[model samples]
Target: MRGRIIVLKHNTPGLLRRIASLRRSRVLQYRDAKGVILLDILPQGQCINAARYCSTLDRLKEAIRRKRPGLLRRGVVL
Candidate 1:
């Protein structure tokens, strides 16, 4: 991946959600538009504040379920 770099900002939680899915790494960041992410990626076996990460993951899962409405979550539960 060698090319020019780009940046983006938004008000909703879309960007963070996408990044969490693609990278699978916890990213605690805040942009100008503002995304108050408690946890970016809840990596396997990472116990960095279990309570918050679990909550964040739950919110993300709920959002996905609500939007997709047909995505059967089997096997690894996010």
Candidate 2:
């Protein structure tokens, strides 16, 4: 997997979310040759603990359902 580094002048929180929420805006996503599949963004200075990890997994499952409907029905390797 690759990591993305976002540079911001301000240190305040919620700025990223605001920009992402704009009309027709886009958020970082996990992609493969097929196309975008999942979006999982971790807030600045935040750690991925159990609760957050579980929720991320839930979001990933939902994304798969929408983006690649047949993926789950067939079978996913990982």
Candidate 3:
């Protein structure tokens, strides 16, 4: 399966719209010039982990699953 990370130089908005077409990506490290663990993809989108919604990543997968189950069921990048 193909996978990639969402990156931003600093605090920005509307990332989901920018990469909305990409369904199987994780919200990896962002605004961290020094490099840090922003998001971690476990089994692409199907197997999302806790790290994806914490700290620098801030994916909010948990919330998405509860509120937006469709997002996860959507077709993956793979």
Q: How far is candidate 3 from the true structure (C-alpha RMSD, Å)?
A: 13.8
Per-residue lDDT of 1-78 in model 1, one digit per residue for the tens?
A: 333232444335576456545553445442212333323544555656778867766776665565543543544533
Q: Candidate 2's residue-wise lDDT over 1-78, tens digit each? A: 124334454434885556455434334566656865665555455677899878877888888888788878977636
Off-target runs (Cα >4 Å) in candidate 2 are: 1-28
Better of 1 and 3 by TM-score: 1
Poorly placed runs, candidate 3 (over 4 Å): 1-59, 76-78
Candidate 1 or 3, higher lDDT?
1
Tens digit of per-residue lDDT, candidate 3, span 1-78:
455544445534765465655566544432223443233333344544465334323344454455456756986511
lDDT, residue 10, model 2? 40
What TM-score against the true fold does each predicted structure earn?
A: 0.35, 0.57, 0.23
Candidate 3 TM-score, C-alpha based:
0.23
Q: lDDT (CA) for every model shown?
A: 0.49, 0.63, 0.45
Sort the predicted structures by TM-score, highest score first. Answer: 2, 1, 3
Q: What TM-score quantifies how close candidate 2 is to the native fold?
A: 0.57
